[model samples]
Target: MEGNESLSSAMQERGLTQVELAEAVNTRLICAGHEGTVSDRTIRNWLTGKSQWPHPKQREALEAVFGCMAEELGFSPPARRQRPATEPESPVERRNFLTATTGTAASAVPFVGAPPQVGTSDVLRLRSGLDALMELDDTRGGHEGLERAALSGAAEALDKQKLGATQRIRLRLFSIAADYTATAAWSALDARQADRAQALLGRALYLARMAQDPVAEMRVWNSYAMLAHQRGALTEAIDSGLAAQATGITKRDPMFASLAHARTAIGHSNLGDRQAALRSLGHAREALGKVDRDQPRPSWMAFYGPAELTAMTAIVRDRIGDAAEAEAASHKALGAIPKQFRRNRALATTRLALAQLHQRDIDQACSTASNGFELMTGAPIPGRMRSLLGDFYRDLITLAPDAGAAREWGDRYRAEWSRA
Candidate 1:
């Protein structure tokens, strides 16, 4: 790489021509919440070093563009206070990104020095503890127990090498988000609470950003957007889902795009955009086809796979009331999923139950949800998974009105929930 040069000239010398630089930088400034107008000629002046800086805001934007220290760029560095970041648009966002939630995925992902022997031990502790929590979950009530279990993981001691560096950081982010989403899944199992799941999963998405991991971030974001379906916050969920698509996962990871499309389908379904939902489903299928079977995937994404394409397609089918297709797809996925990942197997099985019970036989729906009940009961409640079922509960009640049975289940859940 050339020695760092004037921020202006560097932009010109790089692929970006001067006019392009001005436009791109100016647009970024606006996105950064700058209000002032900036022109290409003015940008040209800065490149020629004819004008030190046209504006403080413009200067700051240039600095971010170059990825070089301003001092190294042959210009006096902008004052520390100049062009300060504007307040985040939302308190929730403020905490996750600009403000505070948690950071270190960035530090964790990049392995430096001599890399240590990779072992399952680090993730093992988390995995085993998760196993215990799942084991403790009662089909009747597991979310509450799962919530405590998730909190316990936040305290798990992790070293830099657990996952370190930029690429690994994406994996790290996916893992944390997966854990939280699992916890939320359990919570949603009983309470049908999307908001709670959204908070935790959304935080996971933020963690991915800390590591600058976009692929992981997309999955995390999709996990949370499912909450939108539960809360009837259709627009918000779709918008949130779109963020993943916009982030644009490249490289070999088609699952990122697959997951995004699945969530988009859900959002479109909620908004009653039936065609859009189908379109998104097609996209999800295409994305799934692109995912290399043996490529590394995040633990959080373990719940999803080529098998999920069936479930995802079923979801769209179910939404459109194509009970026959939905039932077949769900059953296919359920059959394909291995039992080694029992936690996920349970959920997929339950989904199969959903398709059968809903489409073929009223008795079948009962049996399937009941079967799901059996698997989910003792299953570890990954918060995100429970969130996935929140709507299932609603749909179950609407279709079956098993008030007494559901109450019995709910009571059992509360008891175990209280125990946890």
Candidate 2:
């Protein structure tokens, strides 16, 4: 059956064994209020064509577990009775049509031939190129043109088969490819293309697994958390963040663990669990303290440091309504971040404005937001920045509906973001 082949292909791409797939499916089923768990034997039967089709509940569980549609998972729904010839298309049908077409186009990239025999020099060049792309993303917030170029470069590198390369060299290439893919996924998320981001992240996770690099895997999982959080899937965000922490703990990497914990804290805060949020924040701080200065850090993690931590702290504090502490943290974050990271500076400034608003400093908040909004006009702003600014705008309108400064700031934001 086509179902068996599709399932097998999905398992291979995700680096999952049949047993692992069974476990994952069962976990999803339990979460979906199903009564029983499937065994590895059952999964084997399904993948070997012994079982041609799953029951409706099982099919749903499988689709949910894999983040795919029924047809993508090789399931054909039962035939429907004939409908009116002029029936109107539903929103769901339109979304499905777009998803299928886009997914097909994205997967149709042509394979490149084998790469030339490479040495450390080639690896170094690739790393440098990736660093440049990352710097652009940090400054300009993921321009679509730049993202496409970066993705193409990384995809070409990954497509090349290097048979003569040493095991160490091959692993390094895999790690580099994974890093690029993860960065591309982040760019997609910044551009508000969630489906594309998820697809890229799945590939990144597979590449990381091939490299056997726990640090890279942790980073990819953290990216998944960020994407989920952006999409308002708080439970998924929490789960992904915890997974990142688990990987980081296995690798004994305090910096990675700290970032994961900080993300988890934000998830908890968003869920209104203040105590859990505070506990996670404390864990994040403790982990950050344990990062050794003598050890070399991963290049992908260069953007993370005290400034990023402070920004996260501000976000959690704001979520929990700790206006005073949030304002202080936001100021600290802004001071600690360098001027080169203009996007981060803008985001921090927005948070600072939000904190000021919470404290009833309407004039100061309007002034801070105006400056931040001006900075955002220099580039194609990230979705996260726009979302934060939206929150600030809503709060300002609610709190100071008649203020001229608030009205001016709102007008400016509308004009700037409309172009964005």
Candidate 3:
């Protein structure tokens, strides 16, 4: 049998390795009250066409994970299992039966004209698009297309929310809308358009409150903290980070709590509160230690693991003028960060370069900084990363105005900077 190119391409686009894909499918299985038994070997079998069709439960979980039909992922039913064309489902029967069952299988088809009866399946379908968007953001950081697509998703969710749904379904739709809006805000922030992000985040927060979704609320607060930090509003950043920590999701998920604490630590350090910052950093580490790695989480949070926390620690240490400690933390982050996260790797490289520069390792700093450009060779540098690089460039010239190495560094990256 030929390899499952469709499945391979899907995984590649999402930057998911076979092991990660297995883990994600298993997480969804566990969430649906099934044993999370999918393994990397099983994923390999699927990719190699050793398994043409997954078990029914696994299929459902895969559909949920990818937000598409099993067939779309290159799975094929055996001849004996294929439904006969002679017994085809009529349009009305298909519609009414699907509306009654509220199954996610119907999600492969888009709703046309009037919105059909909304249900759990509809929410899952919408979330699939969000999952794709999140993957794109991870690969490319931020761009205008991402922001526009997020807003369109939000609009679609809102449109469906008004078309007769159960109270629970209605709230879930609102939550989805909030999630989409928050994604838009995040994209804007990554693009360094702080004002646009602020407005979108405000709207997202309001929608999240309406839905009473603590997770969505926490996501918005996290973005708000980053936006505040970008604007030099350290107090506001701290407050927003604290708000994220206060969200109910943090109480249930230690990983999320750790992220909130880490964000708060950055604000505290930047505000010159070294004691408070270090305290928060300690809290972050403690909470991270208690996280349940096997537990299922939303796709948006795939980036916030130990690697990201270590990166945050580097930022905090840098802000507190602990150059050596910052450099060590940055090194740790780069060592642990996954290869698929090119933007993150580049960002960490820039941070490492900054630490080296602060330590007066002029030649070494220039070399380290150049690695960021290499990491993101084919991709456009994100605005936030470009800003960080700009910071490094200015500091380099200021510290070594007459150094040949500094002049060489500028000559090399000048074209790259202008292109970005």
Candidate number with greatest TM-score: 3
* lDDT for model 1: 0.56
- TM per model? 0.53, 0.71, 0.74
lDDT of candidate 3?
Answer: 0.84
Q: Residue-wise lDDT of candidate 2 within 1-420, one digit each (tens)?
A: 444688788878878777667655554344334643677898887788777567766665565455565456554444563334454342122111112112221222233786347678767766766665666666667544445445654654565434457788888889888887888788788777889899999999999999888877998899898899888899999999899988944357788888999999999998989999999999999888988867776666777888999999999999899989999999999989988788889989999999999998999998998888777664457777888889999999999999988888888889878646
Worst 10 residues of 1 by lDDT: 93-102
| Per-residue lDDT of model 3, residues 244-326, tens digit only | 99999999999999999999999999898999999999999999999999999889999999999999999999889999999
The TM-score-based order of candidates, best leading, equals 3, 2, 1
Can you list the residue pairs that collide in candidate 2?
A: none
Q: List pairs with backbone clashes in candidate 3.
A: none
Over the stretch 80-152, how does candidate 1's per-residue lDDT look in tens digits?
6443356332212111111111211121234468655534444444454444433333232334424533443
**Which of the numbered candidates is closest to the native, going by highest lDDT?**
3
Superposed Cα deviation of residue 105, candidate 2 (Å): 28
